[model samples]
Target: MRVVIVGAGEVGSNIAASLADSHDVVVVDVDPDRVEELNYSLDVLAIHGDGAAIETLEEADAGSADLLIASTDHDETNLATCGTSKVLGDAFTIARVKHVGFLRTWERSSGAFGVDFMVCSNLLTAEDIVQIIGLPAAVDVEWFANGLVQMAEFEIGPESHLVGQTVQEADQFDLLTFAAILRNGDVELPRGDSTLDAGDRIVVIGPPERVYQFATTASPNDAATDTENVFVVGGGEIGFQTARLLQERGIKPRLIEEDPDRAREVAETLSDTLVFQFDATDTEALERENFGAADTVVAALDSDQENLLVSLLAKRLGVNQTIAVVETGEYRDVFEAVGVDVAVNPRVVTAEEITRITREETTEKLTFIEDDRAEVIEVEVDEKSALAGEMIRESIPRLPKGVVVGAIAREQELVSPRGDTVIEVGDHVVLFVDERVAEEVTSSV
Candidate 1:
């Protein structure tokens, strides 16, 4: 596909880097330095100009691009860029915005204005922080199709109950699957005989209700806590959204905004939460709030340096965990080195989201597939489906070609589908078919 990415920042560059391997990618940014860096590092066309300007977009041949992405830090600029690109081409356009008002009011409705999708950085960052805080032991969590299903990661600790267990013998956990393990930095799609040992990072996919139940088994029961008091630094859109999410979850949030006007506006909008006009960088102000008393400290300043510093300071001040919003990949290493517990790139998250919604039929949400030789697929059973009510073993040969039922989801419950397991109506079955026979397998399923 001919893809144009505006911004050339960490998120834009990461998107271009990931997509350039197979697609025609063009990166546009106002910064000549960034453009130069991306042009040499990635096999993508790099152009320097104001992306919000239609003229610059024309120079980059936006009219012919299959998709255009506006991912600059400024919400207005991103919206304008996406709008203008849509006018230049009938291509799908995605904009990265941060304002909650804009997200709630115009995101989906902006299709009339030529935007195919609107990604709110604040919402994405807040969601990431909330999930990470809720499941502190999990490395990552992703929900697909508006939370119909969730994917979670758990690193096998020395005391895990799963150590030395074969793939098939792992606790059923009622409705969750021991999907795949990331061991020694290698992904493995285990089978009945495959054994799991300590230090193996596992990725499990199931409905949220069951996933949370399984998560508790991996960690202590006390891991589930009601984070009632949230301290949010940086009263910008991201900070406000984070505070709003906390409030929605029945948590009382105290937001610290450096700008008095912004703080006043947020305070007026959020009657349920506390808004204070204070510099989060000021140790006196942090101490005044008893920042350590809060369950979580979110460092969401506009500047990456400030976010990193504040997060470090928060950690030093005895906060249980600190989350920082960073804009650059370089800062990821820096943040980790400085002991920041969690970091997120809003642009990268937004880009990944856009790609997911606009992806081709063969595309997968994850870049890393567990089994290179096998393909995992979700095939909904038609009500009148021939395979319905038939035992998997009995239907094995009757299947059109090469499909093998690995797992099945019926009424939001995941079951290890075996030869004796019978498929049912309204079942969303997952098949693990040999790559060579994936098409045949799907045709049969």
Candidate 2:
């Protein structure tokens, strides 16, 4: 498939990189530096021009492209880019916008703004934050196989019970698979003798209940508070949406906003949420509210530095979990490294969501781990699948080396992927694949 992407920023670059290996990709950016960077770094054609302009699309040969993605930071520019692409080709148009109002408008009319699909970054980011809050010890969480299979990444803190345990000793859950151990930014395929470390992030896949059990076992102290008491430190759209989502689930969350006007506005909007106008970085205010005893505290400030400071403060005050919204993808690791439990990047989430649409038929669910260093994908075995009629041991050897068959769902039942287990057609399989071999594994598995 030929794909034309607009705005060569993080989101556009991410989408292009993911699709460049499998499809014809052309990136359009107003910045000459970004276009030049793409030309030298990726296997895609880079054009310098405003993508919302018709002449720019024509120069990029958008008329023959299979898909057109508008991923600029500005909402109107993205919508305009999609509309312009429609005039040039019948390509499926996707627009990435940060406001939920545009998504609501698009949903009301099927092809509003000439966009075939729309992604709301704020809403997506809020959903990501809420999911992390749901799983106490998890830095990331994804569900697959119609919610039967689960994928989670947990950071093993110094207080965790499993910090010093070996993979063999920690293998108490029969239905779970220790997919990969991430230590010091390196992905390690675990052996029975691999020992868990305090700062290591362990990726696991299994049934939802079993994964939840493992999470509790790994961080017993973190899981003790549950999801009852929650605190949100921002009045931005993402924080408001997160509080609203928690309210929907019957959990009233307290929110702190520095700006008095924004705090009043959110207070009026969220009936269940308690909005307080105060600087979250103020140690005295947090203590007065008993924030230390809360089960979870989400730092969603606009500035990355402020969010980092607030997250660390919450951790020092004894908050069970601290999840922060990181605008820049590069700051994610830094935040997590400095004691933030989970760093949610809106751009990364949007890019992954858009890339997901390009490969929807190949996988039921997909999520990028550690900023696209690895991926956990759930795919079904069809008649054309390479591993359809072979045993687990026989088929795995034929695939790429990084592939690990985590679990299988057959007829609504969890099938443990043993060496001798036979993988029949129509069975859904969850696999952890290194990013280097992901494209090959996705095609052949």
Best by TM-score: 2
- Against the reference, the lDDT scores of all candidates come to 0.72, 0.91
- State, as a TM-score between 0 and 1, how close model 1 is to the true structure: 0.75
Model 2 residue 71 distance off true place after TM-score fit, in angstroms = 0.6
Please report the candidate that would top lDDT against the real structure.
2
lDDT of 1 by residue, 38-138 (tens): 88888999999999899999999999998898888888888788878877888788877777667777744648446777777778877877776666446
Check candidate 1 and list the clashing pairs. none
TM-score for each predicted model, relative to the true structure: 0.75, 0.96
> lDDT tens string, model 2, 20-126?
98899999999999999999999999999999999999999999989999999999999999998888889999999999999999999999999999999999999
Which sections of candidate 1 miss by over 4 Å?
Answer: 30-59, 145-148, 155-172, 183-185, 190-200, 221-224, 258-261, 276-290, 312-318, 360-407, 411-445
